[model samples]
Target: MSASPGQNLFRQPRAVFAVAFACVVSFMGIGLVDPILPALATNLNATPSQVSLLFTSYLLVTAVAMLFTGWIASRIGAKATLITGLAFIVVFAALAGLSGSIDGIVGFRAGWGLGNAMFIATSLAVIVASATGGFAGAIVLYEAALGLGIAAGPLIGGLLGDISWRGPFFGVAVLMAIALLATVVLVEPLPKPAVPTPLSAPIKALRHRSLLTMGVTALLYNWGFFTMLGYAPYPMELDATQLGFVFFAWGLLLAFFSITGAPWLQRKFGTAPSLYGALSLFAVLILIIGLFTGNRWTVIVCVIASGVVAGINNTLTTQAVMLVSPVERPVASAAYGFVRFIGGGLAPYAAGKMVDHWNMHVPFVVGAVAVLIGVAVLTTGHRPLAAADAAMAAGDRHTDPDEVAGEVADEFGGAPDAIDFEKELDHR
Candidate 1:
């Protein structure tokens, strides 16, 4: 028997693998600082809350800059954009390593964030444009990078941070430079969008009801996601190496589920129901973490369990947004990114302040509540979301992840009725 699309996960072209490898290294930056958070505070004479600015500066810049990544990529071409982004990361990460003050590191991290935003937004389009197996397979590949990076980041950071707080920063610079080289050598040049993406396009995409609804939902979801990442570590009181192990365990489960559990759950439950369940469960986990902030073991277990929820949500929402939005995929991506990253950026900063002014429980409670609010926000788009489900079920489309389609084939899983995005680009 021929292999199912699900079984054909690893059989990708070199370009896909190259970009995916770069993706893994790029995403590692997200969690690279986790194990080092405490170390920075102690070494730099900063408070835990001030150290939290690292996430804030990075994500806030990413949020704002990602809005224009597509526009920039369209003008410069994808390969150049990816290389530029990688170059920015390499420079800023090294600068951050050399910085003396918390404020200096925070500012350099903002530069790193801009690079990350450009790289991520462009890479997703490139991966989908080149991937094999199927649309679903491509997204799984992308998310796999995210999961692997998340899993490895803290462990590497922890190991490096043990030597010095500056270690992870230097490590990121080296790894990113290698990724830049691989991308240059291995990936073929991708065709730019025929018409340049206007600066106003992504913002205008928000006018679509489905896109807006999903964006708001993601905004709320990220509030919970980043809060866990930014503030949860403070309560654990583990050293850098121990913290790395805990998050490594968490990332392992996250990666495993991002590949296996999410697709299976979406298959059995459909996107909306699976998303509802995952968000609900994650909210409960955050609540548990909040209620037992003093119990290190309890907090650790809940954080690990959250990986499953994060994985499921990451895959499903990605497909759902692609499927439901009426706008072009790149536009939808940029707009969605703009909303979600803003929330992702601010949540941790807020969490730090909340902890200072209130109790540890306060931040977790807010995170849990934010997730619940996301679930509610998602409900408003039920009809369109249901339409997307119908579109997926129309063919043998239930198995794959994302499709790099345009306006004509808005649904993922590559239904027969949909137009091929690459072919469309070729014709144009």
Candidate 2:
């Protein structure tokens, strides 16, 4: 039997905790700038479009670099990748903090994205390889880390950003430095892949229909996701601290739903229906925000409420991609990351430009329509998704155990039988 989520969360090896801790600080980078967007614009004498490039540069570079992570890991090994990524984040985050110009900070943030892609791409494999519970437990732990980091990032940023816009950047550098040290001391080195992954693997994975479908769906969904994440703060017009609290609430819901609520939802509605329902609701919410951009309370409520759907989508979409794809898990993940991050990276900058050229309401309107189109795109793969769901229901599923094993080869390098593939399959 699978362990409960609570048990999975706490009953883990020291190495798991070390990587999970680092995962939390790594995810914090996602929302660290939420409360500071306004301050960044004012202090740097930049327009919202220029300030929005922070997200664009960071995520864009991260997206492009994801294609190479598996290749790098296969050659150098996971521990080296993790440490290298962490080192880059510590240096780049500090450089961003110390930057005198918005353009300079933007450049540094791009560097931070490179490090982030390497860390995030490898962290899951390490968690899966090292965690005590089965693969299910490791996934829950990873998602929990994601939730906590995302939720806390804005709060931390708010508290520090209230002092200075640069405070959050420096704070991340300090925290990441600590995480880097913990990783070095606690986690053992992992084995490199017997055959190094090709640079073209992730791109090749995209040729499969189901993988391509989900990737496109994710891309469209991200258009809505980042539009809200990047632009909604401006419409609400809250100060740094106030914006922090608001997004903290949003992230809290997101974290809670991702860890607990998503499974319940999947159990009740199944994956595809749940996704469609959530996407529909998300579209309605974005439309509502666009309709009522002038109303602060309404916009705030919508922003927070959107997290529920976002959380559900995050968990389900990831599962769907894993279940439906035929490629190795690492390649599938890298491919999905490549496509979705491009959309995520671009949306914020587009929203900022839209606001500059069009109006405040236009971005949300575009976001809503894009989300609906994502729902439509998902329909093309319904038959395959249904097959995946049926396979999952029968307790007979398959994932890339070799890839996961490669991720933490040092811990289980000589003990291939240590991983229970059947239990891991069921858990997903």
Candidate 3:
């Protein structure tokens, strides 16, 4: 039997570490430029709307690319897909550093998004395939990696953006290059799937009402999430270094809660109440940020505290999405990824436009309203969520090792030997 999550979480092979390291660096790209948003706006003589395009370009591209990343991974093999994605990040990030204009940086960020999608598409599967821990253990480690990368990104970005806005961009290029080398050396080649994932699979997966309801809910909540991520920095008026520390605290809280607090809350409150509470809390936080836009301390506090709430919501919502669907974890994950990212990508630019036309409070209040609507959207699929909970309590999960191995290999890409994966996932 696999050890406890705490014990096995750190007891992984070097290959797991290698991919986990790459996962960290890859996720860092999500917030790597956050501290620099204001700096880039000022230095480049661009408007907040233009600077917001940095997020728009990156996330929108990632959103669309989610649809195809599985197809790419299935055909090319996992290691190749991971390497290809890493290579793309290394190139685009460096090019972004070299660019002279805001438009150029924004364009390069779009390219970086493509790489980000590729890496995300395969990294979790690689970890699952190679982890010494079983599936649950692998998730703990994966989520931990996610936390560290997210928490560290801003501190690193802050320190570098303290030097120059280009510093964060170049920093990622160098770090991802190191990660790329590690993957090439440590990770063994994975076999291609016997049945390749169709490009249209994720698109079709959304036809299910449970999946679509959850997807729309995710999208709306993300509107609030990214609105804060994209625009709140401007109102704070802090320099890059201070902004870094502020968001570092935020990321730290997010990471901590994702691993510990979220699970505890879910266990105690159950999924629906936990999600509703977290979502309501997050909306209130966004509304607070809007009401207190002129108060830097208020913005800073709400921004940091929102991390706790967001972490809870992130974990629960993800679980709910998987549980509520009849589809495999990956298809559901990809479908969810696509919709949520679209909301995340567009909110920043739209927030900026709203601010320029009306005021700061409008975008955030609107964002909070969007989240409240998400709470309503979530209600539409209450039966599915409850049934999922029932399924889990009855221990009705698939447990046959051969069945799991085949499913893992089929969804994540693997050779025939993957039938021996031995990692029976109770949950994705």
How high is each candidate's TM-score? 0.92, 0.91, 0.90
- List the candidate 2 regions with Cα displacement exceeding 4 Å: 1-7, 396-428
lDDT string for model 2 (310-357, tens) is: 888887787777666555566667888999999989999999888989
Q: CA lDDT of 187 in candidate 2? A: 96
Q: How high a TM-score does candidate 3 get?
A: 0.90
Q: What range of 10 consecutive residues in model 1 has the weakest lDDT sum? A: 399-408
Which candidate would rank higher by lDDT, 2 or 3? Answer: 2
lDDT of 1 at 219: 93
- The regions of model 1 sitting more than 4 angstroms off are 1-7, 398-428
In Å, residue 306's CA in model 1 sits off its true spot by: 0.4
Question: How well does candidate 2 score on lDDT at residue 8?
Answer: 38
Comparison by TM-score, 1 against 2, better one: 1
- The weakest ten consecutive residues by lDDT in model 3 span 415-424
Candidate no. 2 TM-score: 0.91
Candidate 3 segments exceeding 4 Å error: 1-7, 396-428
Clashing pairs in 1: 136-400, 136-401
